[model samples]
Target: MSRIKKLLMVVVALLLLAVGGLYLYKDAAVRSGVIASGDQVLGADSTTLDSASLDLFGGGLALRGLKLKNPEGYQQPHFFQLGGIDVDVSLGSLLARRIVVPSIALDGVELLVESVIDLDGPRLNLLTIRDQLRSSRVKNAEENSASSGQRFVIESLTVSDLKVMGLMTIPGGGSWPIDLDVPTFEIRDIGKKQKGVLLAEVVGIILVAMIDKAIDMIESDGSDKLKIAGDIRRGLKFFNRGLKESGLDPKLGKKLLDDAIQKGLGDLLKKKKKDR
Candidate 1:
């Protein structure tokens, strides 16, 4: 081999090594940044993750043992808890102090019960966040111009094995676990404006999604678990069948869910009547 050719090869290899090292460094930084962003976007006490690791090859991060504490005045310890989360981001956007995720997913999610006796009701932790998202401003010139402005745009999100388990907070109430398979939830246009957006707004979209799934859990199992709705209907049907084949009756496992579902329907009917 010629001497000059060997020198060029060495330089190219070094450049590749440097780029790979930079990616590794960025991975660590992004993990820490995501945790900090979550804490600030959610409440200080609301977001907690046991561990986070980035996948350079996948261009994303995997977060494990993630938990979201309940809002104030709730007896439950956590409003939402998950085994793991996977997020794929756009590298350019991430470097620019923004989060542009092409894909994100939650694995093994759990939503706890409400504070009061409303077994099938939504948790205040999620409800409060959902309401906040509704009221949040999409763009703020002053906030956007800040030195450390951050925005998130998620093009796709997938939630897997989302379960709702009632803690039996009320006396004489049995346990109730209503499961939903990727309950439908969509929040759009928060990052479209992109110039001026806060972490709180981004986090609120996530929290509201959690709330929307929890509400679906409450609504899906009403006297007719047979009629599960959304893109999840087929998945739910297959899951129920598999549960029975595994020797467990998802519906009859506890009478609590049935009773709570009935109560939910009754309340809805009463409110409708009163409105008339």
Candidate 2:
């Protein structure tokens, strides 16, 4: 072969090897990003994932064994755990200021809500995490603005096979468990109004929505779980106050609680009338 042709062949081989290396390392890099983003929002070193796979050319990502630990003092293994997550990204928008995710599907999600009384006072894991996330939102927003970090736009997000469990610590250290199976729900056009939003904001929105649904489920259970329902109502009021303090609109949260209470009252009045 000619010298120039040999040199050209060597260059191509080197380029191919470099691309191959990038492909091999891409998954780890994406995994680290996910962990970092989650930790930032939660303000704890509790975000973990068993594995991540990223399609270099296709912009598809699959994450397995994603779990978020409960804050300190909680007995449950994890506050939130997911069997898997699949995300479809817009490859072209990756280079732009706004990263666009066309769809995200989360499967086999389990949320553990625990209520306990300690030296500090009564506390709920969900409320604790909500407070942390709310505080982080303001801080994250400032940091993103200062650093010109890329924002995200999620066109659709869906959660399936969600199981919510409640653990209430009773007298003498025993705990009662309440298991609920939640129907699948979807949120569309996240960050559409402002074009894009910080990752923390997106997580905060989803968490709050899920908590709201869980509260509704607890209230509507007409079983002998009225105490649990009362605790949830009080927690909802506290959460609404936090929302107001954080400069967020609390109308939706308050309205939901109000409607639930009204419904319960109306049902009770009807029951009494029928009994008479």
Worst 10 residues of 1 by lDDT: 167-176
Measured with C-alpha atoms, the lDDT of residue 88 in candidate 1 is 76
What local lDDT score does residue 50 receive in model 1, on the 0 to 100 scale?
A: 80
Give the number of the best model, judged by TM-score.
2
lDDT string, candidate 2, 111-173, tens digits: 888764444434568778877877887786667566567788899999888888876432211
Off by over 4 Å in 2: 1-18, 169-176, 222-224, 227-232, 235-276
What stretches of model 1 exceed 4 Å from their correct place? 1-28, 97-99, 117-125, 132-148, 167-190, 193-199, 220-276
Model 1 root mean square deviation, Cα atoms:
12.8
lDDT of 1 by residue, 1-276 (tens): 999999999999999999888766864665566566566555575677787777655677778887777766667788778898887764566667666777777768887755332343322344455554455434333455564766666776776677776632211112234544555444544466654356555665666677676755554553244332342332222222332342334464233334535665345435545877
All candidates: TM-score: 0.57, 0.73
TM-score of 1: 0.57
Q: Cα miss at 98, model 1 (Å)?
A: 4.7
